[model samples]
Target: MDTTMITIVERLAWTSVQTALLVGLVWAVCRLVPSLGAATRCRLWWLVSLQAVAGLFWAQPLQLAVLPAPALAADTFIAGTDVAYAHAPALPTAQVVSAIHTVSSAAIGAAPWWALVLAALWISGVLAMAWRTAAEWRRTRALLAAAQPCADQTLVEALNLAAEAHGLRRAPRLWMSAQIDAPQVVGPLRPVLLLPAGARALQGDALDLALTHELQHLQRHDLQWGLLPAVAQHLFFFHPLLCLAVREYAQAREEAVDAAVVEGRSERRQDYGRLLLQLGVMPRPHLGVASAAPSTASLKRRLLSLQQRHACPKAVAVALTVAVLAIGVLPMRLVAAPPPPAPPAAPAAPRAPVPPAPPSAPAAPPALAVPPATDLPAAPPAPAAPAAPAKVQEKTTSTTTIMRSSDDDSLSMITHGELDLGKRPDRAYVLLDGNASYAHGAMDDVKQARRDLGADSQAFWFRQGTERYVVRDRTLLLQMQEAYADAARIGTEQAKLGRQQGELGRRTGEQARAVAMVAREEALRAVRHSTDINRDAAAEAARASLEASRAAKDARGNAELATLAQRQASLGAEQAALGQRQSQAHARAAREAEKIMAQALQDGRAQRL
Candidate 1:
């Protein structure tokens, strides 16, 4: 494997482990603090940002491992070392910090162009919402002008009085509607109190009650404040909790509005609840420009406040402040800590100075010395007692092969041998002294390769480490297959004949004679027939068994043939590789031999030229 490829694999492994750990840690923390509020949740989401930074760091080494263009490499080096590091000569602490900030900001802030496009779409949506709100506000004001004025003198008198009391230049547009039972704040710019025609004759306390609810909405500026939830929804659209938080925020605002309404008013509990129920029945409108009747819970909260009739604003404020402070402070204490001090550096080892060797000593020899060509020694003779080659040794060997008949009538060759996948010392690899080569493949490939060699081979079914190895003796395989086929045929034929004789004896009712004479004769004939079948089977199985045996024998040979063919087709590649290695070796040898030659080759080469 190439060094770069190995390095990349290591880096990826390192990153994967780190990423898994980081994710698990963040997930655990999130689960632990499940009840944390929206603001803290927003801060906690910074874990995702932290994870992104970790991913960048993890991928950095992988990026460096890949082949890079010269220009890109130059640019990266200059940017990373000169700009990001910014310590080409001697950088100040602030300069280093600034450089780091610049790089980080550049990376994190680098949004795709499509992000800008999406942002434009978001802005467009906001503008559209604002326009719609404005249009609805204008339409509501215009629609109020078309409503009939209330005939009841008391409601008209209360509306005029409340509008003046709230410092309105224009009179509150008095409208009566059978559709809406309770009074509602119906417009944004000039809010109107819509009263039911049946309730038009309401006086003093009832009229005051209706006007107060509408006035509360106007004073709170609920329409503008309601836009906060809309904005929150737009930005945190991906967060479900944030969306829920927006709803809660709106509820809180509405509750606050209701609290303000009944703060001074007294003896209006049943009346307020009735007003809430009245408008609650009316269908809610789509526009945000109007404030509809409060929800049932909000109405209940309102009713509770009205019925309690207590002056407990200070207590509520104190309680809310304590809750908010506790929410904000606790998580900070848990998650934040000061940076630890740097550890002291270890002591460096001392180096000893050595004096030069005495001048009287002969000069040390060169690291590698190559003898001159003319002074080369003669080749040594071969060993006097040489062992025969592996091929010859195997030629005198005893061999056995076994063959058996399958249910499908196909022949099966069986050869027993040990498997070795480099896990065992004794049987590490099959001997392939001639016409063979060997190479390792993956586990699945090894198994398939072994199975392809035929079911009879024991080596094919065995495993060593994660690979399967085929150990084969071709001669032994062929002979044993022939023997087994004959034996199997004899056994099968005898079993069939014996069964038939037993059946005949059972039918004839002459159990003794049928089982003895006829059955014995049938058994003898079966034996002979078995022998004949065995003989024929052995002959028939020989060719196929030999072929299977040869496949095992030729596995290594076939691999070598493929490798050799591949090498032959790439002659230039081999030549180039060989020449490059040889040239380096030859150069070192020539330099060493130069001193011994003593200008002999220089003059000899000049004379030849």
Candidate 2:
């Protein structure tokens, strides 16, 4: 695994841990002050997710986020210095060279087996989600394609009023979609309120309330803020705490929106809840949209939260502040104090002072000395050699065209070209006109393909409503499928066969009933058309004839079944006789071979003699 990826995984792991701890702190605060507002909890959950991401990979450490330049140290800090040992002399050259080293990796010893497993799992999940998110986006586009601006100007006016109430800078576009069963907010930028066709029929202030609910989502920028938990959850899909945190975040977000929706119209809490139930839950884009329908996971929390007071108590606020600061922000500035200054080095002994007087001869005083390589100055480096772009985006496209020369059209050779998409991912490659390698397809054709390919991607047919941050979770779907599979698996082959047989018998009975009803109806119609006199007699005759015909057919069927059984028995007897004759032939052949061998031995003896 790459070191960068390991570092990322490490941060994600710690982030999950930190988020979990923060969640606990919030939980504790909520426990102490159960009256905490939904809005407050919503904010806290948002913070937990944000704190996780901000403190981890996306941002710099708060401790070092901003710092002034350090002043230069006054003296060389020597090692081995001693105040108690008065005889110890100081050495000036023995200064501490450096404190910081070129070691950054946090993992020690051999990388664990699990790290490798997680490394492989890391990008796989991200790609899987990317694919899923794209698919969802395509569906959302198709769903929105059918949606047009609502004709009801009344609703439009109400939407504007709701937008004003929510203090939105720009009101969302109101459109009605036949594809959706409930109202939802779509698009992060240039948001649109997509309502079901049934939403127009909402009574009294119901329309306004619903519009307010969706507008609140836009106001809080819930669609964008919601993506945080989703993204973090997507990265740490296997982290149980992260999942819990995301779930908490989602419910809190919805409840917060609900609270905002009924702020002025507090009496309509029940009406709002009724409206929620009436709208119910429907399949909607979980990747990009903030659905207005309360999901099953959070529905209870949202309904209960409606009655809770919005006013936050000061004590509870203080506790939350302390918890968030302690759990989230306090560690940002925590740095280990610089290592204790090194002791001064010991002085060398003053021994051979008198021996320095020995005479020294001046030998070959000076052979010409050459300067070492280090003495020569380095050649001046090349100036201003331009660096290639960190990434190059060059696309070669070959286009074939048909041209008219004089009078007739002629096919031209392919021409290649490139379009500059500046300052993007920098190394993007797109293979357009995939229609060549991939066959042209339509909606019906794709549907047919899906029907054919449905069994291929079956995970196991299982997973849910989700936020924009992470891809959706499929645990519940999988659980249901596994439960069904378990039940089906528990049955014996004989039992399954018997059950299928019973089902077939029931279907046959139903078919017979349908046939009888059709014949009876025909008879009644014949009677209805019969002229005055012998109508009753004719009807009776017709009924008798039908019964007799049915009895005869059943008798014929029984006779055929008996004949088939007899034929099967005769075949079985023939098989047994053939087996007996085959065994007899094998015995006769063995005896003949033994006799031939004895005669051959006798002939060999005669030849030897």
Output the number of the TM-score-best candidate: 2
Per-residue accuracy of model 1 over 507-601 as CA lDDT, tens digit each:
32322222234323433433343333225455334423433433333332223222222222233233333333333433343243232223333
Error of 2 at 228 (Å): 2.2
Q: What is the lDDT of residue 456 in candidate 1?
A: 33
- Candidate 1, residue 123: how far the Cα is off, in Å: 7.5
Top of the candidates by lDDT: 2
Taking every candidate in turn, the Cα RMSD to the unseen true structure, in Å, is: 37.7, 46.9
Candidate 2: where are CA atoms >4 Å away?
58-117, 198-201, 287-294, 314-326, 329-609
Local error of candidate 1 at 183, Å? 2.3
Estimated TM-score per prediction? 0.34, 0.46
Predictions in order: lDDT: 0.40, 0.49
